[model samples]
Target: MDGPFANRGRRWPNVTVAIIALWTCASPALSQQVSLPPPLASNHATDPPLAEAMQRIEQLEQTVFELQQRQNGGLIEAEAPICFDAPTAELPTHYPIYDSGWTLRPYDAAKTPFELTIGLHNQFRYTGFSRDEATTIDAAGNVNTIPNRNDFDVNRGRLVFSGYALDKDLGFYANIDYSTVASSSIQPLLGWISFRHNDALTLYMGLGKVPGTWEWQQTSRYTMGADRTLATTFFRPSITAGMWGIGKLGDSLSYTVFVGNGLNTLTLRSSDLDTNFVYSALAWWEPLGEFGVGFSDQEHHDNLAIRVGHGLTQTKNDSTSTDQSGAEQTVVRLSDGTRLVEPNALAPGVTVNAFDVWLYTAHLGLKKQGYSFSSEVFMRWLRNIEGTGGTSLESLLDNGFYIQGGAFVIPKKLELFVRGSAVTGDFGTGSEVAAGLNWHLFDKRSARFTLDVTDIRDSPAEQSRTGYVAGESGTLLRAQLWTFF
Candidate 1:
């Protein structure tokens, strides 16, 4: 009985002590912790819930990220993609029109405008011939003595004025040539009026003395000893043709056509007889890209000249003239019929009525990196020139050809060129070799130095008879200082 009471009293005391300890420590709810989202601010309690603040913070972070992405060149939310730099171009912007973008207003016909562009050009040339001494047969069938070794001294100076009408529709350009070579006088080189139509077409009406080949971009072909070619010197007409036209047709084609007095016959006079009208046409075809073929023709009352040239090969065909003689024979009596002749009739001096002639030219060029090498050949034939009697067409019919080559290298502000040319025809055979250096200073202005030699090949008797550069076959040399402004 005593042990039972002792046990009860001990259990009651332990229960009382456990209750006291719990009350002194803390409440059970208070001891448990609640985890809230990341703190919105350092001054606020992080143990509580703040849903609205946390949502706002999340939105702000997203906005910042989006702005950064856009600044770094990213696609925007509602915009098209963009590039920083654009692509480069490869082709030219505009096509080149031969004589375009230079038209003045107020088109007038009679009252022509004038622009004076004056400059001086000069050159010196020496020609040598081989020595030949022979006897000549006169009209009386008599033989005569001859001299040898003749040379010629030549000098040239020119003033040029070329421009367009300032307030009119007409265009005029002229050059006055002063030289010791030919009849010394200021001769007009180019004077024409261009009628404007559109961007690609033009009509030129006036005097035309320009050579068929002198209009090429390369000036070397035309600048032969301050003139053009020897063939042009001998066979070309003066200001006898008129009503010419030239135009650019397409991106790679151009043409020229004219109706003029081809029979005006080139002379040193300002006016001549209007013998007959001649028509000329030229067409250029660019088939191989940078290479072209040029076809030209001159038709006169009783004569015709057809020319064909190649841009790449620099070669031309000059076999247009054909024999017009028939299979027949005839007899002739001289004015002084002291002697009668029944020869083959196909004699050297017989004259025919009319014949066709062809001229061909070809060019071979090596162009690389601003350097150029080129050559040309020109040939012509007189198929027939028969008149009547023993005075046959042979004396009237003339055929000739020429060959030329040149090298243009070391291009800079100043350039150097060397060229050689030879001409052979019924008149005689002559050659020209030239070396030149030029300095380009400003617009259409340049200074140059040129040296050249010319040779004439003629029979001993023929040269002596002419009394020109007689019977000497060699080259004459010359030095010249030239300028064009």
Candidate 2:
């Protein structure tokens, strides 16, 4: 019994010590030691939070990249998928109605169907004559001659306006000249309105150029020389009031048909004596292609073209005496107011019946690189030259031909050319040879300088009819400065 008590006492002391140690470990104020486990290996599947965070960062990075691309002009890779569904705004349609190369145009031309363009054309010329005076002796021993003077003058000063109105289908043009001519102070060169159905068909009405020879149809501003050929000046009527139809047949062919008042007449009202009318038709086929508008001899195309055409007119004469001005009335007059022939030439107070006029023309042109060539032949016939109720007279016949060629010595800047022309008619025969150089200061040929020398040979009868004395044949030196704006 004494041994059991002693063991219990010792066990009690050990228990007390163990309890103290446990208390110390459990006390809040006592510093405690903690052990951490080794870090788990990095793995996306194992760490869902980490993997989601990385995906969010990637999405943010892509957004920044797209925003940057859009800020820099909306440039995006073609293969990239589209990110937006918004529709793009459409732009308004715009069309050009006129050539942009024109020097002047309305400010609103590009935005509207209505447009207006203004242009100016001027030609300054100096002419020197070799023979200042000519003399002629008649059968009655009467000597007739006039002094010919050299001239430095303005050949042409014109204003041009053109455009489309209402729509492109309706086009119009007006060309006015302030220069004086034989019988007029102010001239209306062309004033017309056109209804264009298409390139294949169009109709024109007003005062305009007649559908005559190609040379006659060419604009004065574009002629190769300072003056038109003698054939054109003598034969072609300057202008007419008319209705015309022009159409293109396929790509290389064209046609023109017109009905007009008598040639070169400005009267808008019917006159008792001037009841005659003119009708014309022309057709041209260009085996290679169409030629350009101007005759520059500077090779504007790269192909060859040929044109043939025929024209006819019917006219009547009523006046046979002097007018209120005491000047004799004539059917045909030269540019210098010289009478060539009239019904009165046969006899005083003689009136002719209706006469038929016919004209035929053929032309050939070649343009290749810097080389150019052109030639034309023309023939005219006048039937029924006798007076009314009188015996028949011989029909009048006239013929003319011209050949020209040139090469651009410096491409478009300079050109040298030579031309020869001849005309034969009931009056007589005349020939001319000319050589010239053209200096194109502006590439568009809007500004040019030309110098030429011409030698003329004419029969005495021809000179007489042209108001020159019988023995008028010599050289002419001409210089011209021309500009178009």
TM-scores, each model vs. reference: 0.50, 0.68
In order, what is each prediction's RMSD in angstroms? 26.7, 22.6
Error of 2 at 26 (Å): 73
Q: Give the TM-score of candidate 2.
A: 0.68
lDDT of each: 0.38, 0.59
| Candidate 2 colliding pairs, count | 0
Model 2, 1-485: lDDT tens digits are: 47546445434443443344344323313312212222223354554755574444444333433333333322433334443223222211222233422423332344456766778888878777676348643322345563454777666778888878867789898888765322444577689999999878899999876666766676776667666665555555546788999999898888887877755565344542355567777677767666665566454556554444455444444332332111112334322222434334334554444345666777666666667777777776767655545545577777878788777888888888888776676556666788998888876678889888877765222221122223346777889888887
lDDT of 1 by residue, 1-485 (tens): 47545445434443443343333223322212312233223321331333344444444333333333343322233233322223212211222122212222211223335433455655544433334445433223434454443344334466655556654445566556665555445555545667777657777777664333322323331242333434333332234447866776675565665556542233423232223354545455443244321111000012221223332101111111343322111111111110112222234344343333333344343333334444555544444434344243452232233333333333333445555554454334544444554443331224545455544343211111112332234443444545543
Backbone clash pairs for candidate 2 read none
Candidate 2, superposed: residue stretches over 4 Å from native: 1-112, 136-146, 180-183, 267-269, 297-300, 303-344, 347-354, 388-392, 459-472
Clashing pairs counted in every model: 33, 0
Which predicted model would earn the best lDDT?
2
Residue 141's lDDT in candidate 2: 34
